[model samples]
Structures are given as C-alpha cells and as structure tokens.
Target: EPQGKIDTGAEYEAPRNEIEQKLVQIWEDVLDIDNIGINDDFFSLGGDSIKSIQVISRAKAKGYYFEVKDIFNNSNIKALSKCIKKNALTISQDEVVGEVELTPIQKWFFERNFEEKQHWNQSVMLFSKDGFEKEAFEKAFEAIIIHHDALRMVYKNENGEIHQINRGTSEKLYDLNVYEGLSEKEITEKCDEIQGSINLEEGPLVKLSLFKTHKGDHLLIAIHHLVIDGVSWRILFEDLSKAYEMAKDGEDIILQDKTTSFKEWAVEQKKYADSYNMRKQLEYWSYIDKFDVRKLPKDKEVAVARIKDLRSVGFNLTKEETEKLLKHVNKAYNTEIEDVLLTALGLTISKWTGEKNILVNLESHGREEIVKNVDITRTIGWFTSQYPIVLSSSNEELGMMIKNTKDSLRRIPNKGIGYGIIKYLSKDKMEFKLKPEICFNYLGQF
Candidate 1:
C-alpha cells in the first residue's frame, strides 16, 4: 500500500468454516459494514482501539481470546482470520463487555451547577473560492458537527449534580440553526465583531459564516476557546481536513479515536487538586498579589477592545534572522519555544512598567498527564492551566535568567496546586475593588 492505501483488500485465508464465519459476522457487526472481505483493514475503515476492544470482548464472551493488539497488528479481516486458526470460538452472545470507564475528572465536578443554555459564545465566517458554494459549504459544515462528540456535548443532571453528557453526533445537526444569505464581507465583519464578546461555552463552541469572494476564495470555521483550548485546534483542523478530503473522495468516515474524554480529565484534576501537595502548592499564590505592577506606556487600550473590524497582528522573523537567534537561544541555553516566548513577554511587560519587580502570569497545557493519546489538539477539554512565575531582573544578565528557568519550573510543585490555590485565593470578594475586573488575561495563539 502506498502511504495509507488499502491495497490488500482481499488477502485472507479462513482456517475453519465456523470460526471464520463467526469472525466475519463479529467484524461486520462492530464495524457496521455489509461486505466481508478478509484483506480489508479495520483502521482504514474507521475502526479504533475502543471498537477493537468491543469486538474482543464480544469474542471472549463466545470463548475466544483475541487480544486488542492482535486486532491492531492484523488490521485486515483476512489476517485476523488466519491468526484465529485452530480456535473455533463459541458464541453465548449474552454478556456485554468493553464498557466505558467513568473518568476521575467527571466524578469531581459532577456535583457542580452547570449551565444549560449557551455556556460560551462563538462565531465563524465561511470563505470559499466559489461564491455560489455557500450552500455546499453549509452541507460540509454539518459534517464537522457529526464528527466531534465534544461539540454536541451538553450539561446534564443525573442525580441533583451536574455533568457533561456526550450527545453522540448522529443527525439533529442538519437542523443546526444556520442564518443564511450573507455576503462574504458582511460575514467577515460579523465574526470579527463578535470574536471579542464570545466567552464560549465550557466545551467546544462553534460558529460558521460564508465569505464568498467576487472571484471566490474564503475561510470557514469559528469556535470558542473555553473547551477547545490551544492544542485542540490543531487536532480539530487536521481531522477536519482529512475528513473533508475523504468525503470528497467518497469514502466512509469511521472516526474512532476518543479513548479519553474531558469528564475524565476534569475528575482527575479535582482529585489531584485535593491532594496534600496541592494544598502546599496553594500557599505559593495565596495573596501573592501577582498583578501589582506599574502603568502602561501607550495608555490607549481597553481591558479588551470591542471593535467592529478584527485585525490580525504578529511579528514575523526571516529565516536568517530566526536561525541566528535560534542558534544563540539553542547553543547558549538549550531553551524551548515557550521559555523564549515567555521570557520575551516578561521583558516586554517589564519594559512597559519600567520596573524589575515583575510578576507575570504564565500558562501551560495542564492536560499533559491527564489522558493517554489525548491529542490535546483535537478533543474539547479545559486543558490549559495558569502558572505565575516571577522573573526578577535587577540587572540585565538575560542569559543567566534563561538558563535558570528549567530549574525554577522544576522546583515548583505539580501545576494542580499552583493554579488551584491562585483561583481559590483570588476568589476573595474582600479583595475586589472593581466590578468588571482589571485582571490581566492575554489569551494568545496556540
């Protein structure tokens, strides 16, 4: 197979008639496919580990011992069939297996009061090379809602407490409340206008618009940051591109990669948050007064600017300029992208305040240890956590400062307490001097 091609779609040799027929029936049932070809790859057809387990458990109930890895290695039905030789599985077909384990994260916050209607807001403009393709794009839009369950997830109360319910994406998506007949420019303006106010729901919130050009070329996707944090976007975008490509190629979509869920992460966070280490970590930020700083230089900015036109700004470096700088950052300090970016950000804030008594809030993806193969870039989850680090600079020994960061970060307790403590202390209403706060939150690009 040439890079993802299912070439050997018919290369299986069934050892026993009864076992072979049973395997084929089980595969068809789990995969929801009609045809029974031995060489057909399960993964290529959208089967995943979770689904593999389901098949394995079912086979085990019928007295078969097909390991999960065995399924993965022998993805094609033919290969799996040959591997299952000399083993005629008995089928009881009564007991069920491979049930989803309720994640630890889900257990903790299950008692919290979760909102029902619109947890967060979002908007997006759909652009296309073909202007008349707006309708087609809307059809394409439905596919996204169908693919990701996190998008359809809503808050539900099982017993007096609340929890996230994964309303599996089947079809009510076609009924998505889409406001049609919008010009490309008008759509762009609408999205840019609303981007600032979009607090976005707890999970992955979505918005879409059609930006058809005179000649025709546009972008089409908008989602809230609450659930789909920094890393999830990359995963979402990649899945979107591939799914769309496969659809265009007329292939069946069998998206099967959600081994972990957001609820599990949330439950785990609560667990770790309640630990002894967490309590000590909390001490570091209790009444630390992180925002005590000098004023800004420009002095002309909103805590958040609510403008009609949303413009994009970024600092771009040339290859030579970037390489030379990277060489210094790499050879001198063995620095990371985040360390470099944060150090620069600290320096900017320091220069603006004209004070070295700098206390700035830093952020890192807290989902690193929460789940296995989470692909933080795809599934919707509150995976971002804040870390407040003080980068003191009385003198301009910048190199020394960068070199010592690895140790500074390591010496701190696990992030669970550092952030949890800050949130708890900051919640003190007595410290509140303003209604609509002046807390500094610079939500940046992933």
Candidate 2:
C-alpha cells in the first residue's frame, strides 16, 4: 500500500429526481468524482467514449439502457436521464474476459508490414506553462496501464498465426525520460528520433517522455496503433485527468472496471464471421464483385519506390457553410454527407478519366450490430473496416449521380464491415481480385 492517500471530498447540489439520482451515483463511481451536478456535461467532467460505455453498462444494470449515440449527442446528466426515461432498455451481458482471437483489422495489419520506415507508433506532445507534479503524473500513467488491457498487450505467432496476448494486470509503468533546459528545436528533434525506435516484440508498446523548460514540462505520449485508435485517445485522456487529480493528492488510483475485454470482442467477432448472417452479407458483396470498374487516374505515373511514401493535401469549409450544405443536401435527397461526397468524387473522376464507372475503397468504424447485446462503446481497439464500392456517373447529371451513390451506399450490408468477412474470414476458397485504386474514408468532424 502507498504511504499517502488523497481526500476526494467535495460539495455540489444533490440529485432532484430518481433518474438524476441514479445517474449521479453512476457518474460519481465511474469518474471518481465525489459530487456531480445533474447539469454537468459528460465531456466537461472528463467523461469519454470508454467511460460512456461504462455509463451505459451501469445504467442497464439498473434496468435502463440507451444508445451510445444518445450519450454522444446528449452529454449532460439531465439530458441523459431524459434519454434513459424515453428509451429504457433491458440489461444484456456486455463483457467478456480471457484470451481472444485477432480481429480482421489486426489480421490485415500483421499480414504485411504496413510500416516500411518506422514502426506504426504514434505520438502526441503536450506542453503546459504551469508546472505539475511529475510523480503524480507517473502514478496516473501507472493506473491507466493497469486499467486498459490493450496497453499491456503483446503478440505471439502460434503455428504461423498471430495472436494478441493480454498481460492482465501490469506492475510496471512506462519510464518517462526527463530532459532539463533543452532548446525547443532540440526537443522536437529528440522526440522525432525517439518516435522511430519502438520495438513491438519487447511488449508495452507505449512510450512517454517529459522535457522540462522555462515554461513547464513538455509531455510526449507514444503508442502503437494496433491497440489504440482516435476514440481510444479520448478515453485515455479522460482517465488521465482523473488519475492525475487523485495522484497529486496521494490518493489511491481507482478506475471503473472495464466493461468488455478486447479478447472477448475478438472471439465474438470470429463467431459472427462464421455465422449464417455473415454468409448472407457475403452474398451482397458477391453482387458487388461482379463489376470491374475503372480506377481513378493520376496526373502522372510514379515509380514503385515512390509508392511507399504518400502525401496529403486538405481544404476546409466554414462550420456554417458545412452544416448548411449537409442539411440542404440531406433534405433535398434524403441522404447523408457520405453519399454527396462519394457522388461528387465519382463525377470528378469520371470527368477526369473519361470513365463512366469507378471503384473506390471505403472505410467504416466497423462497430456494426453484428453480435447481440454486446456494447463496445467503451471498448477500444482498431475497429476500422475497409471495403470497396462501385460508383457510376453514366447519367452525367449531378442529381442522378447523387441518387445513384446514395442507393449504392444504402445497399451495402452491415455498413461494409461484411466486406472483410467475405474476403478474409470465409473458409471457401477465395479468388484473387483486383482491389480499388483510390481509398476514401470520411472521418466525422474532428
């Protein structure tokens, strides 16, 4: 046991109604906050996707369940309580433990070395002008490593197949390398140098370092993509805030129990892949595979060597313009932005290459309703699904093209996650087919 403990006593207005009371209890337990107001925003109070799952999981245990989207859309306790009342759901088992199979995304990653120059390690550097306790941050990080299973994961090749092995509880925390009085340029160069040096086999695929400067300490957190994604970052940061607060006061680091272990999700996914429902989904993809659409043409042909290195260019629209455009388009065509974007792309490519039809790879969140009663709102891993879509602009009219794209996207089974099932998981001997040239994924607003 640690020598010192932090006091978590605080005061706030009490819950007024049954729904608010129950929600308050749940938030207090999950967020480790002593007193929570009904009007408090979830994200403002450090609630994240993973914790959101915990909220849903706990609410179901109390005979109320709501959609994860509801939580995202209605974040405050008052709004969430109303949502629960309007949409009460029966409790279902949402957790699984023990060794798990590799998900399709993981299999795809391991099949080939996606990283040619550096390991698939991502890092974020944060600097604060006000100083903070280094020891407290270290303890907070230690708690996070124990709370999240993926952080302590390692891979093993068993009989020519790779499997993710969760270490359960880890007693070790990542050592934060500290540098004092370093120049900003030197610190950046040092961070870049360290970013390329992660060893996947050695395990504990996350690294952190702190650089002390006149302003404060610059913290850099690096993690491998195999076990984490964009949503996971939100959860990790939220937990870190709570943990840091606790550790600063020498309090015991406590986090809400994890809902579903990643291993359990993988096993459930594999079972779903082999089920009759998945076979039906494959039929949908089979129909799509019959079309041999033209690929998007490039300005110039590049050497094979240059294919490994890719560059990106981006443009942005004002918030008002973007929201209005989406609203007008959806209202006019009864479609989402994805349909409008894909239709525009198809039209642009058709005009550029003089091709009536084209093929593009589309990526999705992959958290489709494949398995029953399993909520992964809090579960984190790379749940990205990649599939090919055939787009045609034979009519040459923008409205017709939009309708064609909307109808085509609507026809996809399971939002295209089924594509991976047919191509990768199906036991039937599969044929080698050409893949889409241009990949397009609309990542929801940052």
Candidate 3:
C-alpha cells in the first residue's frame, strides 16, 4: 500500500555475506516472515519499535552488536550489516544486584503516593488449550527474574524516605498457583485477587496464577507498575515463551544475552537530568506550562473517581478503513497514524467544547536515544514519559489540521523525555500550571 522504489514483483537480492545472512535470519525469526531480502525495508515488513528490540537482542545473542538507531538509520540488511560490529559491547556478566536509583517515572509514582500502591500493576492474560507444566513455568520465570534485574526490585521505606534495591536472585522468584475447574467468573475474580497480592516492600513484585477452566488453561501475570511498561511486556513475554519451551523440552534454559541493564539506564538518566542540554528545554516546557487549559464539562461531579466508576465506549473501523488509515492515507500527507488520529481528536474536541486550543497529555514509549552510547532496545523497565502538548484546531480543513498536528508533535524535544526529567529529577522543580484533562497514547502495532 505504501509507495516505494523497491519492486516487489522483481527478483529480490539475497544476503551476500555472513553478517547479512545472519541479520536476514534474525529479522525473519523476529518478524515471523519468510525470505526477507537484503534490500527490503524493515518498517514495510511490519517492523516496529518492539520488533526492532527483538532483532537487536537476537543479533546480540549471535555475537553481533549494534545500537537501535542503527536499525532505523540502516533499515535494509545490506546497510545494517555494515554498521554491525563483530566486537561485542561491554555488558557486565554479573547480575545488577544492589541499590538502584529510581527513574523519573518511578519518582513521579512515589510523588503521587497512591492509596493502594501494591495493587497498582500492569498485567496480561494468556490462554492455551493444553495446560502449562508448573515445573516448566516456574523454571522459566526463575530464569527471567535472574536475567531482568528490574524484576527482582524491592522498595524500602526508611523514615519517610523510600529507596529501591535489586534483590539477589538466589531466593524463590515465583510461585505457580494452580486452581482446578474454575468458571470464567471465578477466574476473573482470581486475577483481581492476584493483582492485589503483589508486595513492594518485601520482594517478588511479580505474581503468576494458573486457572484450569472447562475450555482451556488461563495464565495471569501481574507485575508492579514501578518496573514494567508496555515495551517491557513484549520483551518479557518473548523470553518467557522461549524459556518455557526449552524447559519443557528438558534443555538448558538460556535466553539471549542481556542488553544495557535498567540500573544503568536510571543512572544515565540522573546524569542527563542535571546536564546542560536538559536545562535548555526548561524554557520550552515553561511555555507549555502557560497554556490555558479548560476543564471539560462532566455530567455528574464526584469527589473521587476510581476504576469502578469508569466507563468505556468501544468503536472500531472497518478493515478497509484501517488499511487506509495506517498505510494508504499516509502517502498523501507524509504523516504518521498519530498525526491523523490526533487531528481528528483535536477537531472533535474543539467542536464539542467550542475551543480552538486543545491541550492533551501525551504518553511516549520514553526509550529515546537521549544519552550517547547507551542502548536500551532490549532493556525492560518503566521507561514511559508523560508530557503535555497543545494542538491548535483553528483550521477546520482536514489536510491543514493534519499538517499542523504533525508539525506540533515534531516540535517536542526528544519525544517529551525531558519533561519528566525536569519535573521529577531537576534541582529546582516548579509545579506546572496547566493540567490537561484528556490523555492520548498511540501504541503502535504489536
């Protein structure tokens, strides 16, 4: 659907050298596509931020090393292979087990001091026709806890001051709770129960529950939000599947080589927060802070809103419409899906509220290449950044709106990473004046 110079009907060129051949194989395995040519583009073949991390990790396992940016800059195998280095990056073999500094997101969480901190988590539900083996699942999770340093994180409250530490992996990491003959309703309740059982102070912030139902087995995994984000889930699930299969087959459970650790990223982030570059963005954020945000009219006002009080209305676009939105329409304006979606949202909000200026709280993956020589493509942690952006819906024309929204997003510094740094980690913290009621996030294709 996307217009490009590469001819799909023509004969494709195969990998020429060992590096290119290895890269092609890795890309095929990660993307789950067959016969990826050296000239093929990564994004055209369904490559995204998450899949790029997978490719990087798989390549590193094979003794090849390259940054995530290299993949973006050199999308094709031939060009990427040239940038790949034979010498591996200096990743410490020892487990990162010690006191770890809280990142900007973690600091933001602590600042909130939610009512039930332990119950705040990110979770997933997986179902399989054939039930999983408890032994294999435990072994797989144990391997994961040891490899991903952040999974073993624990918090300690010392005289009103909170600190985090990565506990040693020798202790029991996971316990498989197996329930027999649970109905769908009971399984849902059990998931909620497990979600509330995560202990932040002690250790093992991750919980796993297995429910055996009439149809199939259900697996529920709940991890504290302090250590995991959307991108981290992809890395976790991929490693879990691979490790579980190896354990089931009675083979040694060996995952891919570790990338930069979460601890390293946190340290680098602290340094960057105090750097001159981060300080320069203060004026921009201050300008954004001055935007006048109007509160949306609510049907019923309540003192407090909780999960139980929330309601959602679902909508779906037809398959043909989705195709145009994702691919075909982008060609006309040279825009991304976010630009178009945000334009529509801004226009709708402007019509509803009768306001031209629309303020939105935007969330980004937050794994920007801000620090030099620090690669977190495969690292797992709560690397999400929240920042505010004001979209002007003064122009009603669709084309002009798309162009304006795209330009507005382009003006953000490092995908809004510096906002969190300046707010939570800076020496002189200033409370922001404008708080956007609406939040928007676009999770790219999984």
Q: Please identify model 1 stretches exceeding 4 Å from their true place.
A: 1-147, 154-171, 174-184, 190-204, 286-314, 325-328, 370-378, 415-418, 421-446
Better of 2 and 3 by TM-score: 3
**TM-score for all models, in order of appearance:** 0.56, 0.77, 0.90
Give, for candidate 2, the lowest lDDT window spanning 10 residues.
1-10
Cα lDDT of model 3 by residue, 238-259, tens digit: 8999999999999999987777
Tens digits of lDDT, candidate 2, 1-446:
11221121223445788888988899878766666776665654545444665677667667676766677678767777777744432333332224557777787788765544236775688778887678999889988887676677777767867667776453344547888899989998888767767655556677888898998889999888888876667668768888999999889998654646677677777777778988777666777788877555667776463534777788988967764554344556656667888988988888788887788889876766577766565555777789888888786567777888888887887788877766666676255364888889765432
Model 1, 268: alpha-carbon shift in Å? 1.9
Clashes of 3: 0
Worst 10-residue stretch by lDDT in candidate 3? 1-10
State the displacement of the C-alpha of residue 157, model 3, in Å, after optimal TM-score superposition.
2.0
> Best TM-score goes to which candidate?
3
The Cα error of candidate 2 at residue 214, in Å, is 2.3
Between candidates 1 and 2, name the one with more favorable TM-score.
2
Residue 190: error of model 1 in Å?
Answer: 4.6
lDDT comparing candidate 2 with the true structure: 0.71
Query: Candidate 2: how large is its RMSD?
Result: 9.0
Give each model's whole-structure lDDT: 0.49, 0.71, 0.83
* TM-score ranking from best candidate downward: 3, 2, 1
